[model samples]
Target: MKSIFDQRRERGGGTREAGPDRATVLSISSHVVRGAVGNRAVVFALESLGHQVWSVPTITLPWHPGHGAGTQIVPDDTAFEAVCRDLAGSPFALEIEAVITGYFASKAQVEASAGLIAALRRTNPDLVYCLDPVLGDEGRLYRPPEVLAAIRESLMPLANLATPNRFELEFLTGLGAHDNGDLIDAARTLGCPQVLVTSAFAMLSGSIGNLLVGERSAELAEHRLIANGPNGGGDLTAALYLARLLEGQSPEKALRLATASVFEIVARTARTGHNEMALQKEAASLSHPMAMVQMRTLAGAKKR
Candidate 1:
Protein backbone atom coordinates (compact mmCIF):
# COMPACT_ATOMS: atom_id res chain seq x y z
CA MET A 1 0.00 0.00 0.00
CA LYS A 2 1.26 3.43 -0.85
CA SER A 3 1.86 5.56 2.20
CA ILE A 4 -0.10 8.80 2.60
CA PHE A 5 3.21 10.64 2.62
CA ASP A 6 4.12 9.19 -0.79
CA GLN A 7 0.77 10.22 -2.16
CA ARG A 8 1.24 13.75 -0.84
CA ARG A 9 4.76 13.91 -2.26
CA GLU A 10 3.42 12.73 -5.57
CA ARG A 11 1.02 15.64 -5.50
CA GLY A 12 3.87 18.00 -4.68
CA GLY A 13 2.81 18.65 -1.07
CA GLY A 14 -0.85 19.54 -1.39
CA THR A 15 -1.17 22.11 1.38
CA ARG A 16 -3.75 24.87 1.36
CA GLU A 17 -2.86 28.35 2.46
CA ALA A 18 -5.19 30.19 4.77
CA GLY A 19 -7.48 32.69 3.10
CA PRO A 20 -7.92 36.22 4.38
CA ASP A 21 -11.49 35.54 5.47
CA ARG A 22 -10.60 32.42 7.45
CA ALA A 23 -11.45 32.60 11.12
CA THR A 24 -8.69 32.74 13.68
CA VAL A 25 -8.63 29.96 16.29
CA LEU A 26 -6.86 29.82 19.64
CA SER A 27 -5.46 26.40 20.52
CA ILE A 28 -4.15 25.80 24.03
CA SER A 29 -2.50 22.42 24.45
CA SER A 30 0.73 20.62 25.23
CA HIS A 31 3.63 21.16 22.84
CA VAL A 32 6.29 18.68 21.74
CA VAL A 33 9.24 19.91 19.72
CA ARG A 34 9.69 16.75 17.68
CA GLY A 35 6.28 15.09 17.33
CA ALA A 36 2.82 15.81 15.96
CA VAL A 37 0.64 15.81 19.08
CA GLY A 38 -1.22 18.39 21.11
CA ASN A 39 -0.72 21.85 19.64
CA ARG A 40 1.54 20.48 16.95
CA ALA A 41 -1.18 18.26 15.54
CA VAL A 42 -4.03 20.66 16.21
CA VAL A 43 -2.32 23.70 14.73
CA PHE A 44 -1.10 21.87 11.66
CA ALA A 45 -4.51 20.37 10.95
CA LEU A 46 -6.29 23.70 11.28
CA GLU A 47 -3.78 25.51 9.14
CA SER A 48 -3.95 22.82 6.50
CA LEU A 49 -7.66 23.48 6.30
CA GLY A 50 -7.05 27.18 5.64
CA HIS A 51 -7.64 28.45 9.17
CA GLN A 52 -5.20 30.57 11.15
CA VAL A 53 -4.32 29.31 14.64
CA TRP A 54 -3.01 31.14 17.69
CA SER A 55 -1.29 28.41 19.65
CA VAL A 56 -0.50 28.46 23.37
CA PRO A 57 1.32 25.68 25.10
CA THR A 58 0.06 24.57 28.50
CA ILE A 59 3.22 22.47 28.84
CA THR A 60 6.22 21.62 26.71
CA LEU A 61 7.66 18.14 26.36
CA PRO A 62 10.38 16.67 24.18
CA TRP A 63 7.85 14.17 22.91
CA HIS A 64 4.65 12.46 23.96
CA PRO A 65 4.88 10.29 27.07
CA GLY A 66 4.06 7.25 24.98
CA HIS A 67 7.43 7.57 23.22
CA GLY A 68 9.10 7.23 26.64
CA ALA A 69 9.52 9.99 29.22
CA GLY A 70 11.38 13.08 28.12
CA THR A 71 11.86 16.54 29.54
CA GLN A 72 8.54 18.04 30.66
CA ILE A 73 8.38 21.79 31.23
CA VAL A 74 5.27 23.38 32.70
CA PRO A 75 5.17 27.09 33.40
CA ASP A 76 4.68 28.27 36.96
CA ASP A 77 1.20 29.32 37.99
CA THR A 78 1.99 33.01 38.13
CA ALA A 79 3.69 33.05 34.74
CA PHE A 80 0.94 31.01 33.12
CA GLU A 81 -1.79 33.17 34.55
CA ALA A 82 0.05 36.29 33.47
CA VAL A 83 0.21 35.11 29.92
CA CYS A 84 -3.45 34.17 29.92
CA ARG A 85 -4.35 37.56 31.30
CA ASP A 86 -2.25 39.32 28.69
CA LEU A 87 -3.98 37.41 25.93
CA ALA A 88 -7.38 38.11 27.37
CA GLY A 89 -6.71 41.81 27.46
CA SER A 90 -5.09 41.95 24.06
CA PRO A 91 -7.06 43.30 21.13
CA PHE A 92 -6.08 40.22 19.12
CA ALA A 93 -8.14 38.06 21.41
CA LEU A 94 -11.28 39.44 19.80
CA GLU A 95 -10.17 38.01 16.46
CA ILE A 96 -10.33 34.47 17.73
CA GLU A 97 -13.64 32.88 16.73
CA ALA A 98 -12.95 29.60 18.47
CA VAL A 99 -10.77 28.01 21.16
CA ILE A 100 -9.70 24.41 21.63
CA THR A 101 -7.93 23.13 24.76
CA GLY A 102 -6.13 19.87 25.52
CA TYR A 103 -3.56 18.31 27.85
CA PHE A 104 -3.44 21.02 30.51
CA ALA A 105 -0.42 20.71 32.82
CA SER A 106 -2.06 21.73 36.09
CA LYS A 107 -5.34 22.73 37.64
CA ALA A 108 -4.10 26.30 37.71
CA GLN A 109 -3.55 26.16 33.99
CA VAL A 110 -7.10 24.88 33.51
CA GLU A 111 -8.48 27.75 35.57
CA ALA A 112 -6.43 30.28 33.62
CA SER A 113 -7.72 28.80 30.38
CA ALA A 114 -11.29 29.06 31.59
CA GLY A 115 -10.67 32.68 32.39
CA LEU A 116 -9.33 33.31 28.91
CA ILE A 117 -12.35 31.62 27.41
CA ALA A 118 -14.64 33.78 29.48
CA ALA A 119 -12.80 36.93 28.49
CA LEU A 120 -12.93 36.06 24.82
CA ARG A 121 -16.59 35.14 25.03
CA ARG A 122 -17.34 38.48 26.57
CA THR A 123 -16.04 40.15 23.43
CA ASN A 124 -17.33 37.57 20.96
CA PRO A 125 -20.54 36.14 22.29
CA ASP A 126 -20.54 33.27 19.78
CA LEU A 127 -17.04 32.03 20.51
CA VAL A 128 -16.77 28.32 19.90
CA TYR A 129 -15.07 26.49 22.76
CA CYS A 130 -14.06 22.89 22.30
CA LEU A 131 -12.83 21.12 25.39
CA ASP A 132 -10.98 17.91 24.65
CA PRO A 133 -10.42 16.71 28.20
CA VAL A 134 -7.12 14.91 27.72
CA LEU A 135 -7.11 13.32 31.13
CA GLY A 136 -6.58 9.59 30.47
CA ASP A 137 -7.46 6.52 28.48
CA GLU A 138 -7.85 2.76 28.91
CA GLY A 139 -9.72 2.94 32.22
CA ARG A 140 -7.17 5.16 33.97
CA LEU A 141 -6.72 8.79 34.92
CA TYR A 142 -3.35 10.25 33.94
CA ARG A 143 -3.91 13.78 35.28
CA PRO A 144 -4.31 14.71 38.91
CA PRO A 145 -7.80 14.38 40.34
CA GLU A 146 -7.89 18.12 40.89
CA VAL A 147 -7.24 18.77 37.21
CA LEU A 148 -10.17 16.50 36.36
CA ALA A 149 -12.38 18.32 38.81
CA ALA A 150 -11.43 21.71 37.40
CA ILE A 151 -12.16 20.58 33.86
CA ARG A 152 -15.51 19.10 34.84
CA GLU A 153 -16.66 21.91 37.08
CA SER A 154 -15.11 24.98 35.48
CA LEU A 155 -14.37 24.16 31.84
CA MET A 156 -17.05 21.67 30.76
CA PRO A 157 -19.96 24.07 31.24
CA LEU A 158 -18.24 26.71 29.16
CA ALA A 159 -17.64 24.31 26.33
CA ASN A 160 -19.90 24.51 23.29
CA LEU A 161 -18.43 21.29 21.97
CA ALA A 162 -16.48 18.47 23.59
CA THR A 163 -14.47 15.56 22.19
CA PRO A 164 -13.90 12.92 24.83
CA ASN A 165 -12.94 9.35 24.28
CA ARG A 166 -14.83 6.56 25.97
CA PHE A 167 -12.41 6.42 28.90
CA GLU A 168 -12.33 10.18 29.35
CA LEU A 169 -16.14 10.34 29.14
CA GLU A 170 -16.38 7.75 31.91
CA PHE A 171 -13.97 9.82 34.00
CA LEU A 172 -16.00 12.97 33.39
CA THR A 173 -19.46 11.51 33.94
CA GLY A 174 -18.74 8.91 36.66
CA LEU A 175 -20.84 6.38 34.79
CA GLY A 176 -20.04 3.15 33.00
CA ALA A 177 -20.84 3.22 29.26
CA HIS A 178 -21.13 -0.46 28.44
CA ASP A 179 -22.86 0.07 25.08
CA ASN A 180 -23.84 2.70 22.55
CA GLY A 181 -27.07 3.48 24.38
CA ASP A 182 -25.17 4.07 27.56
CA LEU A 183 -22.71 6.24 25.68
CA ILE A 184 -25.57 8.33 24.27
CA ASP A 185 -27.15 8.70 27.70
CA ALA A 186 -23.90 9.76 29.26
CA ALA A 187 -23.17 12.23 26.44
CA ARG A 188 -26.58 13.87 26.77
CA THR A 189 -26.22 13.98 30.54
CA LEU A 190 -22.84 15.70 30.17
CA GLY A 191 -24.80 18.71 28.81
CA CYS A 192 -22.45 19.81 26.06
CA PRO A 193 -24.39 21.04 23.02
CA GLN A 194 -22.34 18.76 20.79
CA VAL A 195 -20.31 15.78 22.01
CA LEU A 196 -18.20 13.60 19.80
CA VAL A 197 -17.08 10.43 21.56
CA THR A 198 -14.10 8.70 20.06
CA SER A 199 -13.47 5.00 20.60
CA ALA A 200 -17.17 4.40 20.93
CA PHE A 201 -18.83 1.08 20.30
CA ALA A 202 -18.56 0.21 16.60
CA MET A 203 -21.48 -1.64 15.11
CA LEU A 204 -19.36 -3.12 12.39
CA SER A 205 -16.88 -5.82 13.33
CA GLY A 206 -13.24 -4.76 13.09
CA SER A 207 -14.10 -1.07 12.86
CA ILE A 208 -13.71 2.02 15.02
CA GLY A 209 -16.29 4.80 15.29
CA ASN A 210 -16.49 8.49 16.03
CA LEU A 211 -19.92 8.91 17.53
CA LEU A 212 -21.34 12.43 17.41
CA VAL A 213 -24.24 13.22 19.74
CA GLY A 214 -25.88 16.60 19.35
CA GLU A 215 -29.12 18.23 20.44
CA ARG A 216 -31.11 16.82 17.53
CA SER A 217 -28.79 14.45 15.75
CA ALA A 218 -26.84 11.29 16.42
CA GLU A 219 -24.41 10.02 13.83
CA LEU A 220 -21.57 7.52 13.69
CA ALA A 221 -18.66 7.63 11.30
CA GLU A 222 -16.87 4.30 11.10
CA HIS A 223 -13.67 3.25 9.39
CA ARG A 224 -11.47 0.17 9.29
CA LEU A 225 -9.46 -0.32 12.47
CA ILE A 226 -5.72 0.02 12.28
CA ALA A 227 -3.47 -1.64 14.82
CA ASN A 228 -0.79 0.33 16.68
CA GLY A 229 -1.94 3.67 15.33
CA PRO A 230 0.22 6.55 16.38
CA ASN A 231 -0.74 9.03 19.08
CA GLY A 232 -2.50 12.42 18.50
CA GLY A 233 -5.42 11.00 16.59
CA GLY A 234 -7.80 12.62 19.04
CA ASP A 235 -6.07 15.97 18.79
CA LEU A 236 -6.20 15.84 15.01
CA THR A 237 -9.84 14.83 15.05
CA ALA A 238 -10.89 17.68 17.34
CA ALA A 239 -8.96 20.20 15.28
CA LEU A 240 -10.36 19.06 11.95
CA TYR A 241 -13.90 18.79 13.21
CA LEU A 242 -13.77 22.27 14.72
CA ALA A 243 -12.26 23.66 11.56
CA ARG A 244 -14.98 22.13 9.44
CA LEU A 245 -17.71 23.50 11.67
CA LEU A 246 -16.13 26.93 11.60
CA GLU A 247 -16.15 26.59 7.82
CA GLY A 248 -19.95 26.18 8.06
CA GLN A 249 -20.24 22.49 7.25
CA SER A 250 -23.05 20.53 8.81
CA PRO A 251 -22.26 18.49 11.91
CA GLU A 252 -22.58 15.17 10.14
CA LYS A 253 -20.39 16.28 7.26
CA ALA A 254 -17.77 17.56 9.68
CA LEU A 255 -17.82 14.28 11.54
CA ARG A 256 -17.34 12.26 8.34
CA LEU A 257 -14.44 14.33 7.09
CA ALA A 258 -12.67 14.42 10.45
CA THR A 259 -13.07 10.69 10.89
CA ALA A 260 -11.75 10.02 7.40
CA SER A 261 -8.76 12.27 7.87
CA VAL A 262 -7.70 10.65 11.14
CA PHE A 263 -8.26 7.14 9.85
CA GLU A 264 -6.22 7.80 6.73
CA ILE A 265 -3.37 9.43 8.59
CA VAL A 266 -3.25 6.71 11.24
CA ALA A 267 -3.29 3.91 8.71
CA ARG A 268 -0.52 5.57 6.79
CA THR A 269 1.59 6.14 9.91
CA ALA A 270 1.19 2.50 10.91
CA ARG A 271 2.26 1.33 7.45
CA THR A 272 5.41 3.43 7.71
CA GLY A 273 6.20 2.03 11.16
CA HIS A 274 6.35 5.42 12.78
CA ASN A 275 5.94 6.04 16.50
CA GLU A 276 4.44 9.50 15.97
CA MET A 277 1.67 10.84 13.78
CA ALA A 278 2.91 11.92 10.33
CA LEU A 279 0.71 14.98 10.24
CA GLN A 280 3.09 17.21 8.36
CA LYS A 281 3.67 14.65 5.66
CA GLU A 282 -0.04 13.96 5.43
CA ALA A 283 -1.15 17.60 5.21
CA ALA A 284 -3.17 16.84 2.11
CA SER A 285 -5.19 14.29 4.01
CA LEU A 286 -6.14 16.91 6.52
CA SER A 287 -7.51 19.19 3.85
CA HIS A 288 -8.80 16.78 1.23
CA PRO A 289 -8.99 13.28 2.57
CA MET A 290 -10.00 10.53 0.17
CA ALA A 291 -10.36 7.75 2.68
CA MET A 292 -13.74 6.02 2.79
CA VAL A 293 -15.78 6.52 5.94
CA GLN A 294 -19.14 4.86 6.48
CA MET A 295 -21.52 7.33 8.11
CA ARG A 296 -24.74 6.19 9.73
CA THR A 297 -27.64 7.95 11.42
CA LEU A 298 -28.68 6.46 14.72
CA ALA A 299 -31.80 6.95 16.82
CA GLY A 300 -31.36 10.14 18.78
CA ALA A 301 -33.39 11.32 21.75
CA LYS A 302 -34.35 14.94 22.28
CA LYS A 303 -32.09 16.82 24.61
CA ARG A 304 -33.51 17.00 28.13
Candidate 2:
Protein backbone atom coordinates (compact mmCIF):
# COMPACT_ATOMS: atom_id res chain seq x y z
CA MET A 1 0.00 0.00 0.00
CA LYS A 2 1.21 3.50 -0.82
CA SER A 3 1.53 5.85 2.09
CA ILE A 4 -0.32 9.21 2.05
CA PHE A 5 2.98 11.12 2.13
CA ASP A 6 4.33 9.12 -0.84
CA GLN A 7 1.24 9.67 -3.00
CA ARG A 8 1.26 13.45 -2.53
CA ARG A 9 5.01 13.73 -2.99
CA GLU A 10 5.11 11.55 -6.11
CA ARG A 11 3.08 13.96 -8.24
CA GLY A 12 6.26 15.89 -9.08
CA GLY A 13 8.73 15.71 -6.20
CA GLY A 14 9.33 12.26 -4.79
CA THR A 15 11.74 9.37 -5.31
CA ARG A 16 9.17 7.03 -3.89
CA GLU A 17 7.36 3.72 -4.00
CA ALA A 18 4.73 2.82 -6.58
CA GLY A 19 1.22 1.85 -5.54
CA PRO A 20 -0.86 -1.12 -6.63
CA ASP A 21 -2.80 -0.85 -9.85
CA ARG A 22 -6.19 -2.08 -8.60
CA ALA A 23 -7.94 -0.64 -11.67
CA THR A 24 -6.66 2.91 -11.94
CA VAL A 25 -9.31 5.47 -12.89
CA LEU A 26 -8.20 8.56 -14.82
CA SER A 27 -10.01 11.80 -13.97
CA ILE A 28 -9.90 14.36 -16.81
CA SER A 29 -11.62 17.71 -16.56
CA SER A 30 -11.18 21.49 -16.42
CA HIS A 31 -8.88 22.74 -13.66
CA VAL A 32 -9.73 25.19 -10.89
CA VAL A 33 -6.62 26.47 -9.19
CA ARG A 34 -8.01 29.16 -6.83
CA GLY A 35 -11.46 27.62 -6.31
CA ALA A 36 -13.43 24.40 -6.63
CA VAL A 37 -15.69 22.73 -9.22
CA GLY A 38 -15.62 20.05 -11.95
CA ASN A 39 -12.78 17.52 -11.60
CA ARG A 40 -11.68 18.86 -8.21
CA ALA A 41 -14.56 17.31 -6.30
CA VAL A 42 -14.88 14.18 -8.43
CA VAL A 43 -11.20 13.32 -8.27
CA PHE A 44 -11.15 13.89 -4.52
CA ALA A 45 -14.15 11.61 -4.06
CA LEU A 46 -12.51 8.89 -6.13
CA GLU A 47 -9.28 9.20 -4.15
CA SER A 48 -11.21 9.09 -0.88
CA LEU A 49 -12.80 5.84 -2.02
CA GLY A 50 -9.25 4.37 -2.22
CA HIS A 51 -8.93 4.21 -6.00
CA GLN A 52 -5.60 5.09 -7.61
CA VAL A 53 -6.51 8.25 -9.52
CA TRP A 54 -4.55 9.88 -12.36
CA SER A 55 -5.72 13.37 -13.22
CA VAL A 56 -5.38 15.54 -16.34
CA PRO A 57 -6.33 19.12 -15.84
CA THR A 58 -7.85 20.28 -19.16
CA ILE A 59 -7.95 24.02 -18.45
CA THR A 60 -7.27 26.31 -15.54
CA LEU A 61 -9.54 29.15 -14.49
CA PRO A 62 -8.50 32.19 -12.45
CA TRP A 63 -11.39 32.06 -9.99
CA HIS A 64 -14.62 30.23 -9.33
CA PRO A 65 -16.33 29.94 -12.73
CA GLY A 66 -19.75 30.46 -11.18
CA HIS A 67 -18.59 34.02 -10.56
CA GLY A 68 -18.17 34.31 -14.35
CA ALA A 69 -14.37 34.58 -14.43
CA GLY A 70 -12.46 33.60 -17.55
CA THR A 71 -10.07 30.63 -17.62
CA GLN A 72 -6.62 30.13 -19.16
CA ILE A 73 -5.94 27.66 -21.99
CA VAL A 74 -3.39 24.90 -21.77
CA PRO A 75 -1.60 22.70 -24.37
CA ASP A 76 -3.19 22.99 -27.80
CA ASP A 77 -4.52 19.93 -29.69
CA THR A 78 -1.06 18.67 -30.65
CA ALA A 79 0.19 18.99 -27.08
CA PHE A 80 -2.93 17.39 -25.69
CA GLU A 81 -2.63 14.49 -28.13
CA ALA A 82 1.01 14.04 -27.16
CA VAL A 83 0.04 13.84 -23.50
CA CYS A 84 -2.58 11.21 -24.24
CA ARG A 85 -0.06 9.24 -26.26
CA ASP A 86 2.42 9.51 -23.42
CA LEU A 87 -0.12 8.15 -20.96
CA ALA A 88 -0.90 5.19 -23.22
CA GLY A 89 2.78 4.18 -23.09
CA SER A 90 3.44 4.95 -19.41
CA PRO A 91 3.69 2.52 -16.49
CA PHE A 92 0.16 3.39 -15.35
CA ALA A 93 -1.12 2.67 -18.87
CA LEU A 94 -2.41 -0.81 -18.13
CA GLU A 95 -4.08 0.28 -14.92
CA ILE A 96 -6.43 2.74 -16.59
CA GLU A 97 -9.66 0.83 -16.12
CA ALA A 98 -11.72 3.91 -16.88
CA VAL A 99 -11.50 7.46 -18.21
CA ILE A 100 -14.01 9.88 -16.68
CA THR A 101 -14.29 13.22 -18.57
CA GLY A 102 -15.95 16.55 -17.93
CA TYR A 103 -15.97 20.20 -19.13
CA PHE A 104 -14.10 20.36 -22.41
CA ALA A 105 -12.63 23.85 -22.59
CA SER A 106 -12.17 23.66 -26.34
CA LYS A 107 -13.05 21.65 -29.40
CA ALA A 108 -9.50 20.31 -29.51
CA GLN A 109 -9.84 18.87 -26.01
CA VAL A 110 -13.04 17.12 -27.01
CA GLU A 111 -11.41 15.57 -30.06
CA ALA A 112 -8.38 14.48 -28.04
CA SER A 113 -10.61 13.01 -25.34
CA ALA A 114 -12.50 11.04 -27.94
CA GLY A 115 -9.21 9.71 -29.25
CA LEU A 116 -8.00 8.80 -25.76
CA ILE A 117 -11.21 6.89 -25.21
CA ALA A 118 -10.47 4.93 -28.38
CA ALA A 119 -6.87 4.26 -27.35
CA LEU A 120 -7.89 3.19 -23.86
CA ARG A 121 -10.54 0.91 -25.28
CA ARG A 122 -8.04 -0.62 -27.67
CA THR A 123 -5.79 -1.63 -24.79
CA ASN A 124 -8.51 -2.51 -22.27
CA PRO A 125 -11.71 -2.98 -24.18
CA ASP A 126 -13.57 -3.38 -20.94
CA LEU A 127 -12.34 -0.01 -19.67
CA VAL A 128 -15.33 1.99 -18.54
CA TYR A 129 -15.59 5.50 -20.02
CA CYS A 130 -17.89 7.72 -17.98
CA LEU A 131 -18.58 11.13 -19.48
CA ASP A 132 -20.22 13.96 -17.58
CA PRO A 133 -21.17 16.07 -20.59
CA VAL A 134 -20.79 19.65 -19.29
CA LEU A 135 -22.38 21.20 -22.36
CA GLY A 136 -24.72 23.80 -20.90
CA ASP A 137 -27.41 24.36 -18.31
CA GLU A 138 -31.09 25.39 -18.38
CA GLY A 139 -31.12 25.99 -22.15
CA ARG A 140 -27.89 27.95 -21.95
CA LEU A 141 -24.90 26.83 -23.98
CA TYR A 142 -21.71 27.06 -21.89
CA ARG A 143 -19.13 26.23 -24.51
CA PRO A 144 -19.19 27.15 -28.17
CA PRO A 145 -22.18 25.81 -30.11
CA GLU A 146 -19.84 23.63 -32.17
CA VAL A 147 -18.50 22.05 -28.98
CA LEU A 148 -22.05 21.15 -28.00
CA ALA A 149 -22.63 19.60 -31.40
CA ALA A 150 -19.37 17.63 -31.14
CA ILE A 151 -20.25 16.30 -27.68
CA ARG A 152 -23.75 15.30 -28.77
CA GLU A 153 -22.52 13.55 -31.91
CA SER A 154 -18.84 12.60 -31.59
CA LEU A 155 -18.03 12.21 -27.88
CA MET A 156 -21.01 11.06 -25.91
CA PRO A 157 -21.84 8.02 -28.06
CA LEU A 158 -18.45 6.54 -27.17
CA ALA A 159 -19.20 6.61 -23.45
CA ASN A 160 -20.16 3.44 -21.57
CA LEU A 161 -21.91 5.74 -19.13
CA ALA A 162 -22.64 9.45 -19.22
CA THR A 163 -23.96 11.54 -16.30
CA PRO A 164 -25.79 14.66 -17.47
CA ASN A 165 -28.10 17.02 -15.68
CA ARG A 166 -31.72 17.52 -16.84
CA PHE A 167 -30.90 20.62 -18.84
CA GLU A 168 -27.97 18.93 -20.53
CA LEU A 169 -30.05 15.78 -21.04
CA GLU A 170 -32.67 17.81 -22.86
CA PHE A 171 -30.12 19.38 -25.19
CA LEU A 172 -28.54 16.01 -25.93
CA THR A 173 -31.88 14.17 -26.35
CA GLY A 174 -33.96 16.84 -28.15
CA LEU A 175 -36.54 16.66 -25.41
CA GLY A 176 -37.42 20.04 -23.95
CA ALA A 177 -37.03 20.39 -20.22
CA HIS A 178 -40.19 19.30 -18.43
CA ASP A 179 -40.26 18.86 -14.68
CA ASN A 180 -43.20 16.41 -14.42
CA GLY A 181 -42.44 14.13 -17.38
CA ASP A 182 -41.41 10.49 -16.97
CA LEU A 183 -37.71 9.99 -16.29
CA ILE A 184 -37.82 6.63 -18.02
CA ASP A 185 -39.07 8.35 -21.13
CA ALA A 186 -36.02 10.58 -21.06
CA ALA A 187 -33.64 7.72 -20.29
CA ARG A 188 -34.94 5.56 -23.14
CA THR A 189 -34.86 8.41 -25.61
CA LEU A 190 -31.31 9.38 -24.63
CA GLY A 191 -30.07 5.97 -25.90
CA CYS A 192 -27.29 5.39 -23.36
CA PRO A 193 -27.48 1.99 -21.64
CA GLN A 194 -27.53 3.80 -18.29
CA VAL A 195 -28.39 7.42 -17.55
CA LEU A 196 -28.02 9.07 -14.11
CA VAL A 197 -29.61 12.50 -13.94
CA THR A 198 -28.51 14.92 -11.20
CA SER A 199 -31.28 17.53 -11.31
CA ALA A 200 -34.91 16.42 -11.25
CA PHE A 201 -36.66 18.18 -8.40
CA ALA A 202 -40.30 17.53 -9.24
CA MET A 203 -40.03 14.09 -7.56
CA LEU A 204 -39.73 15.82 -4.19
CA SER A 205 -41.95 18.25 -2.29
CA GLY A 206 -41.45 21.73 -0.74
CA SER A 207 -38.56 22.42 1.75
CA ILE A 208 -35.82 20.87 -0.44
CA GLY A 209 -35.77 19.14 -3.86
CA ASN A 210 -34.43 15.71 -4.79
CA LEU A 211 -31.98 14.09 -7.26
CA LEU A 212 -33.28 11.12 -9.28
CA VAL A 213 -30.84 8.27 -10.14
CA GLY A 214 -32.53 5.98 -12.65
CA GLU A 215 -31.68 2.89 -14.69
CA ARG A 216 -33.33 1.27 -17.75
CA SER A 217 -35.33 -1.89 -16.89
CA ALA A 218 -37.85 -2.79 -14.22
CA GLU A 219 -35.49 -5.20 -12.42
CA LEU A 220 -33.19 -2.28 -11.80
CA ALA A 221 -34.13 -0.56 -8.57
CA GLU A 222 -34.85 3.17 -8.59
CA HIS A 223 -32.80 5.34 -6.21
CA ARG A 224 -35.23 7.76 -4.63
CA LEU A 225 -34.39 11.48 -4.75
CA ILE A 226 -31.52 12.74 -2.61
CA ALA A 227 -30.65 15.82 -0.54
CA ASN A 228 -30.18 19.30 -2.07
CA GLY A 229 -26.81 20.41 -3.49
CA PRO A 230 -25.29 23.23 -5.47
CA ASN A 231 -24.23 23.35 -9.11
CA GLY A 232 -21.19 21.30 -10.25
CA GLY A 233 -22.03 18.86 -7.46
CA GLY A 234 -22.75 16.56 -10.37
CA ASP A 235 -18.99 16.26 -10.82
CA LEU A 236 -18.78 14.61 -7.40
CA THR A 237 -21.88 12.55 -8.09
CA ALA A 238 -20.51 11.28 -11.41
CA ALA A 239 -17.15 10.46 -9.82
CA LEU A 240 -18.79 8.34 -7.13
CA TYR A 241 -20.90 6.59 -9.74
CA LEU A 242 -17.82 5.82 -11.87
CA ALA A 243 -15.85 4.53 -8.87
CA ARG A 244 -18.66 2.09 -8.12
CA LEU A 245 -18.78 0.99 -11.74
CA LEU A 246 -15.03 0.39 -11.81
CA GLU A 247 -15.39 -1.64 -8.60
CA GLY A 248 -17.68 -4.09 -10.44
CA GLN A 249 -20.71 -2.90 -8.52
CA SER A 250 -24.16 -3.61 -9.92
CA PRO A 251 -26.22 -0.79 -11.41
CA GLU A 252 -28.62 -0.67 -8.46
CA LYS A 253 -25.84 -0.78 -5.90
CA ALA A 254 -23.83 1.81 -7.83
CA LEU A 255 -26.76 4.19 -7.76
CA ARG A 256 -27.30 3.66 -4.04
CA LEU A 257 -23.65 4.23 -3.20
CA ALA A 258 -23.45 7.25 -5.43
CA THR A 259 -26.56 8.71 -3.80
CA ALA A 260 -25.27 8.07 -0.31
CA SER A 261 -21.86 9.58 -1.06
CA VAL A 262 -23.24 12.68 -2.81
CA PHE A 263 -25.83 13.52 -0.15
CA GLU A 264 -23.27 13.12 2.59
CA ILE A 265 -20.98 15.66 0.94
CA VAL A 266 -23.79 18.04 0.00
CA ALA A 267 -25.00 18.36 3.57
CA ARG A 268 -21.58 19.66 4.52
CA THR A 269 -21.46 22.01 1.53
CA ALA A 270 -24.88 23.35 2.41
CA ARG A 271 -23.83 24.15 5.94
CA THR A 272 -20.52 25.71 4.99
CA GLY A 273 -21.70 27.63 1.89
CA HIS A 274 -18.74 26.16 0.07
CA ASN A 275 -18.35 24.91 -3.48
CA GLU A 276 -19.77 21.49 -4.27
CA MET A 277 -16.29 20.15 -5.01
CA ALA A 278 -15.15 21.04 -1.49
CA LEU A 279 -15.33 17.48 -0.13
CA GLN A 280 -11.91 17.31 1.56
CA LYS A 281 -13.26 18.47 4.91
CA GLU A 282 -16.60 16.64 4.75
CA ALA A 283 -15.11 13.36 3.55
CA ALA A 284 -12.75 13.49 6.54
CA SER A 285 -15.72 13.87 8.91
CA LEU A 286 -18.06 11.39 7.24
CA SER A 287 -19.25 10.17 10.62
CA HIS A 288 -21.16 13.41 11.11
CA PRO A 289 -23.14 13.06 7.87
CA MET A 290 -23.88 9.40 8.60
CA ALA A 291 -25.20 10.49 11.96
CA MET A 292 -27.52 13.19 10.57
CA VAL A 293 -31.21 12.41 11.13
CA GLN A 294 -32.17 12.61 7.45
CA MET A 295 -29.15 10.68 6.20
CA ARG A 296 -29.49 8.11 8.97
CA THR A 297 -33.15 7.58 8.09
CA LEU A 298 -32.33 7.10 4.43
CA ALA A 299 -29.42 4.81 5.28
CA GLY A 300 -31.63 2.75 7.61
CA ALA A 301 -34.01 2.12 4.75
CA LYS A 302 -31.09 1.01 2.59
CA LYS A 303 -29.84 -1.38 5.28
CA ARG A 304 -33.30 -2.90 5.49
lDDT of 2 by residue, 224-290 (tens): 3434445566787788767665555555555666765666666657767664445666685321234
- Local distance difference test values of all predictions, in order: 0.87, 0.63
List the candidate 1 regions with Cα displacement exceeding 4 Å.
1-21, 301-304
List candidate 2 segments past 4 Å from native.
Answer: 1-22, 68-71, 177-181, 207-215, 218-230, 275-277, 284-304
Q: Quote the lDDT for 248 in model 1.
A: 64
Candidate 1 yields a Cα-based lDDT of 0.87
Residue 257 deviation, candidate 1, in Å?
Answer: 0.4
lDDT of 1 by residue, 1-304 (tens): 4322223335443233434335688999999998899999999988888888999999899988888888889899999999999999997776777899999999999999999999999997767899999989998788998999999999999998999999999889987888777788889888888899999889999998999998767899999999998999999999998887777666889899999999999999999999898888887899899999999998865343
Name the lDDT value of residue 253 in candidate 1.
90
Candidate 1 residue 34 Cα shift, in angstroms, is 1.4
